[model samples]
Target: MPASTSKSPRVAVLADSDTRWKWGALTAHRLVPGGRLDGHLLRGRATPTPRQLGEVDEAGVRPDSVTEVTAAEFLATMARERYDVVVLALVGGGVQAMLHGLTHAWRGRERRPVVVTGYVGVVYEKVTDGLLLRHGADLVLANSRRDAERFRAVYEGVGVDASAVVEVALPFLGGAPYRPADPYTVVFAAQPSVPAGRADRAYLLERLVRHARRHPDREVLLKLRSRPGEHTTHVEELPYQKLVRGLRPPANFRLVYGHMGEVLDRADLLVTVSSTAALEALHRGVPTAVLTDLGVREALGNHHFVGSGCLVSWDQIDAGRVPVADPRWTQRNGVAPGDAYGTAFDAARGRIAALLGGAGPGVIAPYYDARTAPGYVPGLLARYHLGVDGVPLAGAPRADRPSGPVRQVVRRAARGAYRHGVQRVAPVVRRLGEL
Candidate 1:
């Protein structure tokens, strides 16, 4: 355990959105085994609102402090605090940029924080591309045994070190087995970008309305990730909340917000097009279904559940059909049986201990650099206002944290504008340009 060191190791988790923060914060506790932690929310289009962070924050593992910062400001903090571990709970581009950024930030230093990065959910798309961008982390977490194997294939194929990929279950899985509440409740876990088209989202909403009408004795909850003007890990072009505006559903049907775990407390059945919530439900033995109503396409992401035996349609469910997930499938995909979760993080902890236990921390460079990826790497770093050398570009404004009530209002307004641009402006502009 940490080589019996006198000083408790420090950890920093830099997350971009609400869901990532939930995964990352819990992961930090598991990695260090006994160290307190701090959080950094990257200033971006998808930064979590106060309510979002509040819902994800756990009792014991909540960071002692949380700071909002941009790419440049984060680099400065890393150098100043000298944390023992830094978790890059970000998108692939953010991780890649931060890898280079940290290399420069820790240059010539004897010790550097052991960097960790990984996906928060099922890796259905961009398998190789995502793996490559996340290559340099000292621990790249794979949420299942299957995930670890696939990760090795991609890295070993490209002559990159695959040892960093560690097998660990999703850190957010903890809930009692499903027990029926007074009224059977079915929750449709909505994703921000699963069905990107308005018509598709509306269709799903309409079907849920039909279900609520047909089963008046049942409670149907449409679990949403964000409110109207807020954002999540992905851009939501057509949010289910927006699509439900024109629907007249039964009184038993409603929209819910808060922790998915808390919602699962009363849920007898959970449904989703393609959400990490499906895994959470299965972990708790809640009856879960991966909807094939919209066709199990890769774009829809239900294809990842092809052999899970939990794939069924709204029509079948309407006919009182229940999909029983194959037990073997669940075990292979990191959905360990109930009560077996405590061991899931042990492997990750041992790996971190070995790194932080031995000689002073070492610096690891990313796969991409100015020379190896001349056409690509520079532009990616520039998006974060960082140069190819991983230093702040000249004239980049300082990203000091904003405070005071007036500034808080301004921050919310800015977030609203950014969401409008992503959901409303960018799509129209793209369509027009194509024409």
Candidate 2:
């Protein structure tokens, strides 16, 4: 990689889902002000659809180009592109697999691009395992002061280098400060799988409808991430849309979908189970709540908001109680009231700049190698259609495809079928097995 291109630095982001793509694309623009940014979306079960991309691209991060690639195909494209920076906005396993695969593919290269990886939102589970899985990159972005501290502890505790951890805030956290729209709006940022059961999801919807009835003067909006046939970052077994079918609500209550920030424009209160939208709402100074009615459990992720003072029950919310976030908690978690968020990415930008201007960073050395992760590594890479040798499997797609309309349609149909199986067929089959 002795600088194949002579102009501005090249940045390529490899993303898996819509949320990661939004974070990665926005991060690229933040890291390199004018650098050419291209995107690679891994072909998978959760690959962002055209509609989903359009939803998040409102941040003005529509990439110069977006291509679909498998793990081996991405590596092959990396060999030819000679990018200045590569961002891995993927799940933990995907990041680890790509790190090892890239290490092998770029062996003995004259120079290598700086690699980056990080989480999309609050890290509420599998702290050690997830951090170590994303261990090997030039920089592993920590989205808050607390996250940075935890990340450092995990790396040092395991005898790994902790210098790569850099503090940064969520990239998509900018919008007009809350001005309080007329009629006083309430928006519930729905989660796909936080509750992960039809009973819980339906109960929540019933509560929302009841709330609308309780306060007819105030407008209530259910902000959904995707429709019935679509997939998002998480597997939505029971969409709120499906649950709302059996309930009749007042005209004042409605379901809406678009950019989260746009909906925040009219919101006087933001409520969620544990979606990242709560942080976004806090960034824009909207009154926010993390529901505790389901119990403050790690499984629901509401426990992460315990000290934030945003936790409240729907019973409390309906009783005219407004939740206020703790300032110390907000600052610690990177919500940083006022001008602090404007500088959240300053450190990240400077770090990337130094790496680009100075000597190249060393090779990508993931924590899990064949010897270290003998029981797990092979299967993980195999799912991406990569062999134990880190080469493309015989039947795997080996090149990045700017897919045509027909291919796109077929891909959509295949994904719809997979989601249907997860949501419908599997549960019945399991029940039958039990009987």
Candidate 3:
């Protein structure tokens, strides 16, 4: 199909978190350079952190144009001003429900926008969540060929057509020129909330701090996921600051917070329990280590690093032994430069173009279509759209206030309880079972 001769396609990206917004912003940036696209960002129920807002500004997404709108407002905007495409950079139950509402609101409309959705990072778990999101989308983008294949199997198991799934490279891998780091700079990319019993965040930080002490000349940077008081999806994270308090970390040992690319750029050796940052480090030719001292295989998602030869332990880091990543594993996992994993920027551009140029309104799953009308009011009132204190503008009498902010508070409390139980009570139960 030829390019539209009239005007650029109007695109809107709905994102929940900073990292997720990056995926959308990178895609939007790629689309704009083609001179045939106009992109805007919509703040979902999860408000953007200050760092995320900064990132959007830096990505050339005009701050004036970014809108913080309710789900009803989003749907109203879509209804009033038809967009060519609406990309969802969201996750979990919130996303699944949003997709349902969007499809329902647009049902039978002559000018419905294409719905594009996908996971923000490598999909290690939550297969069901991924499937639910994909089922209602016009195009479901996968992070790699391997991921695309996995999605196909999942779709097949559920008896849904898997033709909509397409493989695209990780967006962050593009355009950043790799610069070598200073000698003996080891960066531990911290993810404080892994599945329970997989890895200990404090233990990992302690080992790295200890290693830095053993070799005072080396710099050890603990790269944090978010700054203090910043909103993030990790509800149960134990901040690295809390973990290292009173240890009196050496001057050379620092807690850093910035872009992953910049962090990896200055890392001579990148250490992680099971972070996608390892893949980025390998892409930049940094010596990478997937710490396996605490857990192995699926427990810590170290299976993905198996053939990479980058998996290591505290002893190895202490002894100044950093294992080099295998290029084969890197290539297979879609980190290596090549067509095997389509270039993220280029793939995004082409996919959007194809969706716009193709005939018909695109596929709308029967499941979402059937649930549209019945779900409109409740979906509009759902927490992702309305704050816990918010009420519908008019019409039907309010049953009970459904505010997302209140639910978020409740969810966080539950997560705290769960984490506490897992840490304190689970061990005793396991010991009793062993006896």
Candidate 4:
């Protein structure tokens, strides 16, 4: 890389792994010219996926564009190369690390644009690029406007610049529309986070099987979604035999694994708890029932039956006969399908464009339509504690001491320890080897 006196907006994106690197590379290729695109992947020991390798090969992005390095390594590169913008796609603890480093680097130089994608599962509450922006993220592109607004609301007191919050529709949501035969068929969508119904999921599966058995003539469907390598991890634990043993399963009780668009075609009702699949079902004019707890009910508000009908609790399903598809929900939420879709799309795009430093008319265009994400973060955090997938604590937890100075000292000390731990370990290990 040489210092040329030019005004082109060159960007350096930080990816977590090769697969992430490929996505960043492709996005840059579409948005920025070749010479302006620079992609750096975090130096993780994880092996590159086949699809990732394939994407890299097809894209023909040079090896120079995709270097493996630590956050510090990439930060040094950004400083040396002088990137105009930085797009960070890493999630979880990686998100915090990127924010810390970028904040430090930005403090010393001219302000550079910082945009991050927030698509991780809702398990980690209050942890997002939304949180990063508080540290100094120029823009945080949420998957939807509802999410973007929620981000703004969540960080209201934190003092992050609100203008930089945008919501863009996720690339995966570009699925085909779903239309059922008579709006009477029902589909139970499966999520990766095993539903917390009954002590054992097998018991719940048995209950669902019994429901299918009772309604032998009605169409019953089960659609499951998991990541590329998660099939084996999730499936082996599921009780397939007991759940499907006795009765001849209904014609609609099909096991859907991938590509939700195809399975949603004949589904009149979609059932799930806290899965974004419900949003997909809503977009496709299918009624949805979130059969979990009251928390989900509270987050989504009362209109469960929009394009679809919603039943909050499993007991409500039996009492209300939700799979039957209530007509009121359909009429209210799905009155004018095309017009509604266009409006939702427009709202999402406008919010996203505004966050990304763009303006009104162009932001609301069809190509940038962002859909709302049906996620409840507070509930997720309540269910899953912070230690495993959250910010690492120093000597003592933050909750133990709420005083400003105490908390700040812990955070600063933790950061210092993390930064120097690798250096400290090298010498002691070398001395032990001599012994």
Clashing residue pairs in all predictions, respectively, total: 0, 0, 2, 5
Residue-level lDDT tens digits of model 3 in 1-435: 233323655667777667777776666555444333333334332356567567655545542256555456565556566667677777655455556556556666765676777777667776765565557677777777788888888887777788777777676664353555555688988874663332376677778889888988888999887776454545434566766888898988999887777777677888887888877777777788888888676766777677889888899778878697677767667685645434454655576667666664564663323244354435433545432223223542222335468865865566456656644577678879979
Off by over 4 Å in 3: 1-6, 31-46, 59-64, 175-180, 195-199, 297-299, 338-348, 366-435
| lDDT of predicted model 2 | 0.86
lDDT of each: 0.86, 0.86, 0.65, 0.47
Q: Flag regions of model 2 displaced more than 4 Å.
A: 1-6, 400-409, 430-435
Clashes of 4: 5
Q: Is candidate 1 or candidate 2 better by TM-score?
A: 2
Scanning candidate 1 in windows of ten residues, the lowest lDDT window is 1-10
| Tens digit per residue, CA lDDT, model 4, 1-435 | 121334665666776654345545544433344447666756443323344544455445543455545455565565566654466756444544455444444554543443444443232243444354233345455545455667676566554345555554433232345555663566776643354332345555655665566666657766654333322111223334334556466564555544455667777667775555665666566667767543444343323333344555666665645543454543333222344433433443344334335421111011000121114322222222222222222332222233367754764565445434433454456669979
Candidate 4 worst ten-residue window by lDDT: 361-370
Using all chains and alpha carbons, the TM-scores for the candidates as numbered come to 0.95, 0.95, 0.79, 0.53
Q: Between candidates 3 and 4, which one is better according to TM-score?
A: 3
Q: Which stretches of candidate 1 lie over 4 Å from their true place?
A: 1-7, 58-60, 399-410, 426-435
